[model samples]
Target: METSIPPPKRLKMLDATIKRHQYQQDALIEILHRASELFGYLELDLLLYIAHSLKLPPSRVYGVATFYHLFSLAPKGVHNCVVCIGTACYVKGAQVILTCLEKSIQIRAGETTPDGQISLTTARCLGACGIAPAVVFDGTVLGHQNPELVSERIQGWLQNGTN
Candidate 1:
């Protein structure tokens, strides 16, 4: 998916960054941030390269990446949508909202639209059960969401590029 940037070129960039950071093990998170920013996602190849570059085990790199919600392993679309599927949210029609989103965006859960404009994701819980049926567009959480309002907000993002 990162075909736009050649792997060798990315490695070269990583090498420079590692050298600049002095390859300190503590810079792992910063290195990861750089890698993610450069490549748009942290693929295994990128993580392995980072570990090798930093003289750390691949597992450590992966552990850090997976531990933080700020990091994403999969490529994201221009816009991100994470629907809550926790029990409380589900009971409040979160699944209906998700289904409507899938239909409207023409992408199933865990997928980005063909146009690369929308990524549909699911979270077991957003810890906003009090609001139930929450949807996060980009990074802002919308509580008490219904299908119509979610669709309207998505349309707004499609038209305006912000939510």
Candidate 2:
């Protein structure tokens, strides 16, 4: 089941921007980005708010969101881990690494931990394919990962209050 997320004050600011621009259709992506930045992810209500304020259909807004890989529909945890699965990383066993992470964290891809400590996800590429099997934690990239090493690193981070 999905939980309700209150509309953040940032949505009001986005609304103003949309209105100021006379609700330009071209601004949809920017508006959605701003909303995601404010709320951590695009909640359903927030998407509807943007659609209503911009006079666009919610389906169009959702399509734009899903078309781009950056937008997340679910709430993110305090620490976000994005593992790259591009061709370079995949050949280096990135999929195995992700499975290990799921075992350790008990949450599958795109799911947050029960304690809200971490969210695990996969990306097509982090643009660091040279460093195959790359993983990003809170914007810091750690490349050339071994599955065992990745688990240890996550444990260390949680233990050290990095989460």
Candidate 3:
């Protein structure tokens, strides 16, 4: 007979969050936010757990998780790079900056590097239009960016290592 291992403490915390929300279906987004906070990313098993707990269909749970860009189905790397491609940033050559990163890192947008050192993604708008062609490196918003500067920053992360 196989013994069952108890779920992680985070799972229990998620349960508390669900309970706090009274399991109302409308609170699905809030529940998911807490789940993601407890877990770095939303694993399939966790989503299923939430669905079962809320008495929601698995499809609905999956749909909500995928619908929002804020949630990540997969784990993120130690360092994260999010580029703003909103009208202001795009018009200022955000695409060129993104392309430079892809070529240098050999990974497309919304993908993490093979070694998991960095995860690259794009945001529709960071609300920093004044600084067009903006990129967020490790949560720090950078403005007036260029391919050379972005490349240099990434190279620095690769060489110096990120926390």
Candidate 4:
């Protein structure tokens, strides 16, 4: 069974974080970052509360949160696999790696595994063009990635805690 924090507790924590930052409207991005870090994702209620506390329009808050790729409104898994899909990475066959991973885990990109063990996401770029086709697995950037290598890494991460 997974231990989870209640919604009210999460809201309180976010409120505290906002208060600590003085609830400045200009601190919206930072507030969202802290919220996502604490709750794993920003739910609708949290978004609304943030907008209300900031004295900003909900649309503005939502737009800012959605405009940035760093903020996630969906739940993430314990492990995250982010494949770079930049021009260099694409030229190096990043899509092949993504497809292979999807086949391996039976979950497409932007989705989490059924067991909630892993999540697969794609990035515009990981800023590793020299070592193109980089994939960030659990925050570790592995460049020069290929389908076979990515598959092996995924399998290893599944069988072991980390790789």
Candidate 5:
């Protein structure tokens, strides 16, 4: 008798996405987006599977994943907070907001909270320069942010336990 282990359901879904894209190397970015959507974050093993499935070099896949700010190799928390440090935002005091959040949460950029409740990260640009000093909280971009405003928002999350 012969038996084979079945792949995890999520992996199967990722495979389907790859198949839908015809496994074309040029479709890498789209496939990666789907994979990230399905997996929350792209771990090394998942990236390897993708590289192997597309017959591309692991290094190449890794490079692509790392090159894009949208891709995250590490696990994200329930609530995501991304501070934009673009020139416009910086000049508008985005750095001060970021610093306040870090001090309030006791976690640096790219690090998740100890409780896994929030993930703090920074972005080069969110393309909302007109609103400069923008911050993204749980996917909703809030513009013209200040340190006090951000701190209050973080407090609400901490107290309400909401994402």
Candidate 6:
């Protein structure tokens, strides 16, 4: 789908930060961080804006964004669930866990719910292998997940925001 790419806007606060840092190339990371915070995700226009302001190439900005797993090109969900697909989690049946979640939530990886309440995705590793079959809701990690428990927990989050 071809979405409209809006023109870039100059963010005064980010401009000031860039100025304070003397527009150092190293400051790109910091600038992108602030931009992500302001806009929720690193949209293409925002990337172009940063590139123009910093006199950097759009490709360079995109490269840095993609290099970091924390940066997302798409809009984030109000609620997010990240299941770990690391070897440990996989061995513990994380695939089954993810399948149950997909069925219950009715959204696949890299997609948000129709109401935009949740986005589901899988991570290569969360570095918490001791707790295999782990899923992270928002930023909180839930370990040792079973299918029923995963469904119930997601439902609870939708209904009560307990997660």
lDDT string, candidate 2, 80-120, tens digits? 88889899999999999999999988999888888777889
lDDT of 5 by residue, 38-144 (tens): 87788999999999999999999999998787888888877899999999999999999999899999999998998988999999999999999999999999998
- The local distance difference test score of model 1 is 0.87
TM-score of 1: 0.70
Clashing pairs in 2: none
Per the 3 Å backbone cut-off, how many clashing residue pairs does candidate 2 have?
0
Candidate 5 vs candidate 6: the TM-score winner is 5
- Per-model TM against the reference: 0.70, 0.87, 0.89, 0.85, 0.90, 0.80
lDDT of 4 by residue, 1-163 (tens): 1138776777788889899889899999999997887778877887898999999999999998887766777788778999999999999899899888999999988888877788898888889999998999888999998998888888887998544
Clashes of each: 0, 0, 0, 0, 0, 0
lDDT of 5 at 1: 5
Cα lDDT for residue 34, candidate 1: 83
> lDDT per prediction?
0.87, 0.83, 0.89, 0.85, 0.89, 0.82
**Model 4 spans > 4 angstroms off:** 1-9, 161-163
Please identify model 3 stretches exceeding 4 Å from their true place. 1-7
Span of 10 residues, lowest total lDDT, candidate 3 = 1-10
RMSD of each: 4.0, 3.7, 4.4, 2.7, 4.9, 4.9
lDDT of 3: 0.89
Name the 10 consecutive residues with the lowest summed lDDT in model 6: 1-10
What pairs collide in candidate 4?
A: none
53-163 per-residue lDDT for model 6 (tens digits)? 889989999999876756778887778888898999999999999988888889887677887788888888999899888999788898998888888878987997444
Write the candidate numbers in order of decreasing lDDT. Answer: 5, 3, 1, 4, 2, 6
Residue 132 accuracy (lDDT) in model 3: 88
